[model samples]
Target: MKKTCLNINATHGGFSLIEIMISAFILALGLLGLAGMQSTAVKSTIEIQQRSLANSLITDITERMQLNRLWLSGAGNSYSIDSLTDANLSIPNCIGSGGVFVNCSGEDIKNNDLYEWKQKFTGAEVNASTNGENGLVEADACIAVSPASGSDGELVQIVISWFSTVKSKDAAANAGATDLTNTCGTANAHRRQLSVETYISKSS
Candidate 1:
């Protein structure tokens, strides 16, 4: 019997350079997408926090005003502060004979409340640091009152404005949305604002 010789060829079984490069490209793209999403989420979260804080501050002042019915009853008439500034509010430390918390009078309490509220904006309170929980930026407030026809009630409008680090996309469209021209004190690209309206009865 005669033996026949056969030749066989062997090939390497690993990924080619092109395949590795493609995989690397795909991974890079995925990472980039994730980074973009994270950035957008952070921005959105910041905006939501700011809005919530503003709402809380507004509610706080409103509740205080409601509690002081005498002050809001047009007797003291301290509820109608317009374009209130930090300089406009001043309150002495409320302390008793033995360093206790002294109860202020009706109008005095109103002044104290206004001072405290403005301090939240200016970050002057002990709990408030610069750009702290009180506010992310310089803030201002306004209070307006309108007399109602007959004996219904008085319309009160409260507005809070703040400078925003994030630029507004629709600022032009919302140019006339608020009357807070000097909110940030300068014509900046980023400006945020909130407003609340309520009616206070004359009887209150």
Candidate 2:
């Protein structure tokens, strides 16, 4: 009898359960890292928008002050204000019944400017009732005019302060937050502010 060679087929190699689990874990880690990155991007974008809004607000108030230089220069640095929500602020009627422009005294124009500026922050200008809808969180503004040091005119300081949803990177900043930072609002880790200063003279 001739001996016939018997052949056995080798088993195919495939991923084991351990290998599959490891691959899944690595994939999950990568997905989690991607999600974290997206969240940080959103937060940073919001912070940047808020910063831009703050700058715009400060610039607006500064321009208004410059327009009233005749009044501000003669006021002896008395054109100052704090807390945009101050109930004492009186809104003046600068528009006539026919939606016509009316000439107003410098004082009336100043009051109107303040009221309109507050409306911008209060969302009323945007047709929304929410406060701080101008990309600010619990925002308030201050206009402080004082004698300019080594200058021939009054120094006008316009500051816009807001609550920041983002936490501060410096622990000491959060701890040391105060009204001193913005001259209007007390801040914690979430405090942010923008300010501009210019010298105004009556002669100019």
Candidate 3:
């Protein structure tokens, strides 16, 4: 047998510089995407929380009004103020048997309820000069009522407005104005709103 010479060439394989750079770029892009998603999720969560709080506040006032239906049908009907503020809702401390917890009469209760409701916006004690609470900022509420038409019952409309973290040119342009529909018409894009309506029968 004749011996034949065998030549074997072995080449090592590894990533090139360009390949490494490409991988790094891809990783950076993925990280950026993840960061963006996280930011969006946080914003969405905050918005949901704000909406839930607004709903709760609305429900609270609605229940209070229902409880005092008698008063709501009478002098308390004035509760349907177009724009509500702390001054208009002010009331003296509870008097008589119930003390601070329970108001003395229906009117007293209504007053107390209004005062408390205003506090939710101002986030301070009745006598506090400034808002110290971390609740909604610059929150406002509007109440409108239409008298019963035939047998359709009385219509009550509630609108709540609050300032958001976002800014809008339209909102900023109309700042300091008294237009409730354009509450965010100032420069704040973060303005949010919630509105609800209910009917109260004359019998109820």
Models sorted by lDDT, best on top:
2, 1, 3
Off by over 4 Å in 1: 1-4, 93-103, 122-134, 170-189
Expressed as tens digits, the lDDT of each residue in 94-193 for candidate 1 is 7445635576677777777787777665556645444345554666677877776786467777877766767874233345534533432345567677
- In terms of TM-score, how similar is model 3 to the real structure? 0.72
Candidate with top lDDT is 2
Segments in model 3 whose C-alpha atoms lie over 4 Å from true places: 1-8, 85-91, 95-103, 121-134, 151-153, 166-180, 183-188, 202-204
Residue range 124-201, candidate 2, lDDT tens digits: 766564433554777777777778777667877767777766787422253333433434665466777776777766
lDDT (C-alpha, whole model) for all candidates: 0.69, 0.70, 0.68
Q: Which candidate is the best by TM-score?
A: 2
- How many residue pairs clash in all the candidates, one count each? 0, 0, 11
Question: Could you tell me the lDDT of residue 182 within candidate 2?
Answer: 37
Summarize candidate 3's per-residue lDDT along 1-204 as a digit string, tens digits: 999999999999999999999999999999999999998888778768777877887898888877877766663364566656535765656654445554367678877777778776555653365534546666777777777667635677777777765554333344346444553222355667777887766446
Question: Residue pairs in steric clash, candidate 1?
Answer: none
Can you give the lDDT of residue 171 in candidate 1?
Answer: 30
